[model samples]
Target: MFTTGYAANSATLQILMQKEDIAILDMGVHASVHEGCAFTNKKTFPHNNLEALEHILKMSESMYRTKLVIIDGVYSQEGDTSRAKEIYDLVKKYNAYLMIDDAHGVGVLGKTGRGALEDDGLLDKVDFITGTSSKTFGNLGGYVIANKKIASFLKFQSRQHIFSVTAPPSSAGIVKAIDLVDEEPIWKDKLWENINYLKTGLNDLGLDTGITCSAIIPVKIGDQNKMWDIGRILIENGVYTNPIMYPAVARKDARIRMTVTARHEKEHLDKTLNVFDDINKKNAYCEKNNNNYA
Candidate 1:
């Protein structure tokens, strides 16, 4: 395991640099992945565009020592899952490896929180799977899973693993979380219920919740300044959430990212929805007022 999920992502690219000359990435991968790829020759494909991936794979097949394709199991902003099985098949056909960074998906996907790899039935096939303890384990660290030789190789050769401060509490916490996940399945059920309730509430008000299939829902707001203004309103009303804007999203696709968890109650969701609905109306009225003044 690495110190942080970011370290895990960056270290994966570093390890690939050992033999892999080129990496193909999904455009919307976490910024840490982009930063990790700083020294590698890389190409980016449009989000989930297999055709674009194929083009790069065909070009790199004869040129690179190792060609690796990387993607997020779940996009942190929009929450859509990757077509992992398709990508796995496509990369295999090109004699390349696929690395899935499932930092957001681990402990949040699958019937048993096996993450997107399990959901896609690719736990054994995919060359590498990386994830974090922060989100689901509620701890601070990251891990990489692969064959014995690769895992051993990274354990010895990985720079991030070498220099980071060691952890005992954090490691214990993650282990405990794993045990809980195995024993208590009810958390997942309640989590999905909260997700659907909140999503329905947002939909009923006509807010543009982007293509989220997981709990990381985003209420799309195109204007960044206006999105910040609404964010302030939510804060005043006691709903804390992230404002997703460029370069996290397209300039025109700024949004308020909302995450639902088993720890949240219906009362908490109703409070959030009430504030959102109130602020939405206020914003609309102010817009009409400004137009009248014009």
Candidate 2:
């Protein structure tokens, strides 16, 4: 299967594709995909660039026996999306399988938050779909959603699935989370509302939130030290945020990531912006410093 990874999932992908013999049409921004085949000849393409993916597939027709296209439904760092439908079509044309990691999209998109496949209306077209039980689902476990053939195969051959301990009793929580995503449309609506409000507010502040239309907002802060300092300051002010430092992202492209929730209200958004403004005043945070309070 082709996929993007983050920890547990990445390790599994690494074991699956151990050599350079197989071709992987990979998105440059997928961290796990990059690491999976550290020594393989990966055809790295622009993130969500369907045309680039198509080129890779065309090249693979002569370069390898099997072609795999890996992508993410909703990228974690950028909060941008992959054109799953388009990629699925491209893969079908090339007679290749497409694997998608829908970690950020699950429990957040689609009619019932079934993830990108459902959101893109190409659920049946995808060969494999993987995701975590965290994020909007608010649980702790990983899942691989696929056809019975793939499911049965993994149950027997996927090292991670076979050797790993049984999922915690919290698997029950995942069930509930899925139920919530299905039963409560208001949650998704509220989440989108918060995302729009926060993103707009940050843009109004002249902060470069970076190509994001999702709940994950990345405020580019070039310096790692500054990123950590801002995270501490925000926490002190009662608003916790994530500091993505170098290695995870490119060097000097550190960011204080913000995640908006369906539970957040107008006052919460207002206060978040207020804190950013207050911090900017003391630190002279500006575009020059790459300090975006987004």
Candidate 3:
């Protein structure tokens, strides 16, 4: 295990990438992955753009060095899932390694919370899996899951793991969360229910929710100023949410990132939807005639 999700991501890439090695990262990968690969040759493909990924992989076949592909199982910003199985095939075809940062996927997706790998039956194929202990785990560490050889290798080679120490309390909390994930199936079910309700309500209001298939949802606002103003309005209305802008996303794709949980009741969702609906009608932000915000 590692100190944090950021640490896990950074350390894994650091261990895997050598000088002259190539890292092909999906554009939506967390920044920690980018930072870890800073010393190596790296390129980013558009989110889930398999054609671009293949082109890079095909070119790298002759390099005779490590060519690693990195992607988040569920993109943190857009809440969209990557096609893990298809990517596994591509990485295998080039005799390269594949890594999944299933930070958002664990304890949320899959039957019985086995995460994205199990959800897609990819455990035998992926070389490394890293995730945060904070989400759903209510802790403050991260972990790297791999084969015995790689695990032993990273134990000494990964700088983040060697230098950082995780507190006992954080470790205990993650253990408890893991127990709950095994014991409590209803939590995931309830969370999915909330996700569906929220997405449906936002869609009915004509908000551009993007291509989300998970709990983290984005309501596209498109303009930085408008996104911030709407975010303030949400807070003023006693609804808390995050505003996406600038380098976190393209400037033209600024959005409101919302997350739903098992704890939220139907009324809570309805209240949020009502606020969005009222805002939609009053501001007409989703309409062409009111496209000034875009």
Best model number under lDDT: 3
Q: State every prediction's TM-score relative to the real structure.
A: 0.94, 0.87, 0.94
Superposed on all Cα atoms, model 1 deviates from the true structure by an RMSD in Å of 2.9
Q: How high is the lDDT of residue 8 in model 1? A: 86
Expressed as tens digits, the lDDT of each residue in 44-87 for candidate 2 is 78777777777777777876655667788888888888877878
Tens digits of per-residue lDDT for model 1, 78-174: 8999999899999999999899999888777886888888866898888888888888888889888889998998888887888778766648978
| Best of the two (2, 3) by TM-score | 3
For residues 219-244, could you state the per-residue lDDT of candidate 3 as single tens digits?
A: 99888887888888888888899998
Mark the 10 consecutive residues where model 2 has the least summed lDDT. 1-10
lDDT, ranked from best to worst:
3, 1, 2
lDDT of 3: 0.86
Instruction: State the local distance difference test value for candidate 1.
Output: 0.85
